[model samples]
Target: MISYFNDYANLCFEKFGDRVKYWITFNNPWTHAKVWHSYNKTWRNKQQGMVGISLTSAWGEPVDLTSQKDIEAAERYVQFYLGWFANPIYSGDYPEVMKNYVGRKSAQQGLGMSRLPTFSVQEKSYIKGTSDFLGLSHFTTRYIIQKNYSALKGPSYHTDRDLVELVDPKWPDPGSKWLYSVPWGFRRLLNFIKTQYGNPLIYVTENGVSEKLQCIQLCDEWRIEYLKGYINEMLKDPLTTHMEMVTEIVVPTVFTLCILISAILLMFLLRKHN
Candidate 1:
C-alpha cells in the first residue's frame, strides 16, 4: 500500500508538480509517519513541493478547572486524538501518557504487547520532523472529566482513554448535533498545537459548521456569525498572520446581492439601536 501510494505520488509530481507548490500526502491517515518518510526520501528534492497531512481535532477542556483529575483527563483526551498522530510526526513517538495507559490496559488484558504501535530508535529519528506543515481542522470543544472504565471493557480507543466528554447546553448549536459554535476552542487548539509542536507552520484545512435544517436562506446568518467568531479568534494571535488558513462558503450570484443588502441593513439597524 505504501509503495503504491509512493508511486502514485511520484506520478502526480511528474505531471502537475510544477504548478502545485503544496501537496498533502494524506488526510488523517492512521499510520502516516512511515509514508511521510517515504515521500520525503523520494520526491522532495526532485519535485520541490511541500508535503503535509491534515489532522482534525476538537479542543478538550477540563470539566472542572480546579480538579486535577479532570485536567489530566482533558489533556489525555487531546493526546489520544491529536497527539496520537501529531506526536509521531513532530516528536517521533506516541505521547508517553498514551503509551503508559495502553500498556497498563494490555497487561490487565493478558496481552503480550499494547495495541498501540511502537517505533524503534532509528524509525523514530526518521519519522520525526517529517511534516513541513500541520494542517488543522477544528470546530468545537468538549468538556472532559475522568471516568474509570473496567479493563473488562477491553482494548478499544474510547475505553482506553478513560474520559467522559460533555458539552454545555448554553453553547450555540447552529446545525450539526456534534458541532457547536465554540469559537474560543479554536484559539485554544491553535495555541496548544503551537506550544506542543514548536509552533510549526499551520494551515486550517477544515473549519466550518453545517446547517441541520434544509432551507434556502441566502443570508446564511449562522454561517456568517460562525466564520466571524472563529476567524476573529484566529486573528487575535500575532503568529496567525504567518499561518495559512482556508474556509470556503459558496453563495450563488442571485443570493450575493441579497446577502449584501441584508448585511448592510442589519448593520444599520444595530447602529441605530446602539
Candidate 2:
C-alpha cells in the first residue's frame, strides 16, 4: 500500500507539481509515519512541494478542574486520539501514557506483548522528521472523565483509553448535533500542539460546521459566528500566524458555481423551447 501510494503521489507531483506547492499525502492517516517518509524520500529533491498529513482531533477538557483523575483522563483523551497519530510523526513514537496504558491492559488481557505497535531505533529515526508541517483540523471540545474498563471487556481502541467523553448542555448547538461550538477549545488545542511537538509549522486544514435545516439560508449567521470565534481564538495564540479555513472557502464557492451552472442550463433550455 505504501509503494502504491508513493507511485500515485509521484504521478501527482509530475502532473501538477508546478502549480501545486503543497501536497497532503493523506487526510487523517491514523498511521502516517511510513507513508510520509516514503513521500519525503522519493519527492523532496524532485518536487518543489511540501508534504504533510491532516490530523483531526477535538480538545479534551477535564470534567472536574480539582480532580486529578479527570485531568489525567482529559490528557489521555487527547493523547489517544491526536497523539496516536501525531506523536509518531513529530516525536518518532507513541505517547508514553498510551504505551503504558495499552501495554498494561494487554497484559491484564493475558497478551504477551503490547496491543500498541512498536518501532525499531532506525525506523524511529527515519520517521522522526518526515513532515515539513502539521495540518490540524479541529471542531469542538469534549469533557473527559476517567473510566476503567475491565480486561474482560476485550482489547479495543476505545476501552484501551479508559476514559469517558462528555459535553456540556450549555454549549451552543448551531446545526450539527455532534459539533457544539466551543471556540475556546480551538486555542487550547493549538497551544497543546505547539507544546507537544516543539512548535512545528502548522496549517489549519479544516475547521467549520454543517447546517442541519429544512431550508437554505444564505446569510448563515451561525457559521459566520463560528468562524469568527474560532479564528479569533486561534489568533490569540502567538504560534499560529496563518490558518486555512478550507470548508469556509470551498463550500460556498462550490455552491455558488453549482447555482451559476444551473441558471445557465435553465436559460439554454428556455431558449431551445422558444
Candidate 3:
C-alpha cells in the first residue's frame, strides 16, 4: 500500500517537478520514503523544491501544572496528535509513550506480538531527518488529565493514549464544540515545535473557526476577534499566524471602520439631541 502511494507521487514528480516547487507528502513510513526520494534524490537538487508534511494539533494545557500525571498526559496529547506524524519524520520513530502504552495494552490483551510495529534500523535511518520543514496547523487549547481504560473497549488509535481532555468554561467558545478561542496556546505550540524537533523551520498550514454556514456574515465579528487575539499571540514570539493576506488586513480594517463610523454617528445624534 505504501509503495503504491510512493509510485503515484513519483509519477507526479517526474511529470511536474519542473513546474511544482513545493510538495507535501501524506503520512506513513512509505509516504516519507516516496517524498524524500522524490525531492532529495529526484527533484530537490535539480529543482530546489521542498517537501514536508502538513500536521495539526490542539494545544493541551495540563489540568494541574504541578501534577506530574497531568503534565505527562498533556505530553501524551501532543504525542498522540502531532508526534504521531512529526516524530517519525524528525526523530525516526514513534514516541516512547506511544510504544510503551501500546505495547503494555497489547500484552494485557494476550497478543503474541505487540500491535504496534517496530521500525527496522534501515526504515528508521531512511525516515529520519527526511523532512525539510514542519508544516503545522493548530487550534484552541484543552486541559488534559490521565485516564486508564480497558482494552476490552477495543484497540483503537484514540484509546491508545490514556488521556482525557477538558476545556475551561470561561473560554470564548464561538459555538463550535471542538473549537474555543484560546490564543495564548498558539505561542506554546510554536515553542513546542521549536524545542521538540530541534527547531525545524515551521510553516503554519491551516487554522480556522467553525461557524454555521451562513449566506453572508458581513460583520464577521466573532472570527475577527478570534484571529486578532490568536495572531497577536503568535506575534509575541517570532512565529507565524495563518490566513490569506486580503482577509488578514482587510477584515480588521473593515472592523475598525465600522467601529469608527458607529462612534461618529452616535456623537452626531447626541449633539443634535443636546
Question: lDDT by residue for model 1 over 71-173, one digit each (tens)?
Answer: 9999999999999989999998999999999989888999999988788999899788889998988888999999998889877889899999999999987
lDDT of each: 0.85, 0.85, 0.81
On TM-score, the stronger of 2 and 3 is 2
Off by over 4 Å in 1: 38-42, 239-274
**Per-candidate RMSD, Å:** 10.3, 14.0, 9.6
Error of 1 at 86 (Å): 0.3
**For model 2, how does the per-residue alpha-carbon lDDT over 41-147 read when each residue is reduced to its tens digit?**
76667775788888899999999999999999999999998998899888889999999999999999999999888989998897788788889989999999999
Which has the better lDDT: candidate 1, or candidate 3?
A: 1
Clashes of each: 0, 0, 0
Residue 234, candidate 3: Cα error in Å is: 1.9
How would you order the candidates by TM-score, starting with the best?
1, 2, 3
Runs of candidate 3 exceeding 4 Å displacement: 27-30, 212-217, 238-274
The residue-level lDDT of candidate 2 at 73 comes to 96
Maximum-TM-score candidate? 1
Clashes of 3: 0
